[model samples]
Target: MKWMEKVEHMYDQFTVREQKILVTMVLVVVGFVFFMFAFFISDAFDERRERIRVLRETVTLLQKNRNLVQESRQAQASLELKAVQKPPMLQGHLDQIAKQYELSLNFTPQKPKDLGENQEYQVESVELKLHDAPIKNLMQFLDQIERGNYIMMITDIKLTTRRGQPDRMDPVLIVSSYYKRSAEELKALHDKAAEADKGKDKADMKESTKTTKDDL
Candidate 1:
């Protein structure tokens, strides 16, 4: 207490400019120390918060992907159990389709030329030499083609009546269509599927044999 009182007395006796300089120096040093401590603590907290936020976001993304992965696995399991037969006998299917429509027409399937990657190619075109028939038949034929199993589209059309000969009016319809590797690819995929089926069959046989031996 006595030392503090003597220091206060000495501080009061100093000149105004000296007191101001001493006060300013002490304030500057204190402000610098506070600024450094605040900056360090703030940076550390911000870094920890950022790490927590990133971890939370990562967990959310993983959970979302987990559902997708589960769905894909289920789909794979179903596909492995049951699969469709492919390269569906085009000629027979086409004949059946034509018969179903009762359309007197010719189907000229061309040899499929390989189109380069991601390029489109024309598949088959049905040239209909229409007889003197009602427009209803034509509409039905077009509708059947449009709604058929394979992808088919109507492209080029030409309608012409005879110049001189009456009672013989026929329209020439040349329709272009596009085909993809969906069916052929499906067929090729079956090669691998066949191997998988054989493996499954063996596994099933082994299980059945083991069950029979246990029963015995």
Candidate 2:
């Protein structure tokens, strides 16, 4: 009680100017505390808002990627369906290629042996015994083999001078070129080829059917 009374007496003894100064100081301190709290809350909200913004952006990007993936899958499915409808025509195409390349196939075509469930063609050497030919023909033959559809490999080569030809040191080249199918590689190549041909045939059949139906 005595302390309270002394405090009241001291407050009463202060001049009006001192009293105004004391009130102002208390108000300023209270205002400072309020400002500090407001600043702290504002900073916290700002951080949370920034984090939300980043998460939203990440989600949007992921959604875009998902859409792109779906589109790619759809495109691939359509292409596969088309391929499945066509028929295989690689042999005819190979013949046409041979004609276009002007390559004369000296070897007889043989039925490729089925190496059991392996549909991939295997290349076996076709040996040839030839007298030497001119350098130009030899090079052309090699070039044709390189550019041909079937893999042609030269297994053996012998160079000899032409009989009755003088200065025969630059002898004519006799090459044994072997033509064979590609090595048996299980890469679904045969399946894909078959599917592509099937797709082409289906597409043609559908067109023909459409034409007949229209005529009717």
Q: Model 1 over residues 6-43: C-alpha lDDT tens digits? A: 98999999999999999999999999999999999999
Best by lDDT: 1
Per-residue lDDT of 144 in model 2: 54
Model 2: CA > 4 A from native: 1-6, 69-216
- Please list the C-alpha lDDT of all candidates, in the order they appear: 0.64, 0.56
TM-score of 2: 0.33
Clashes of each: 0, 12
Q: If scored against the real structure, what TM-score would every candidate get?
A: 0.34, 0.33
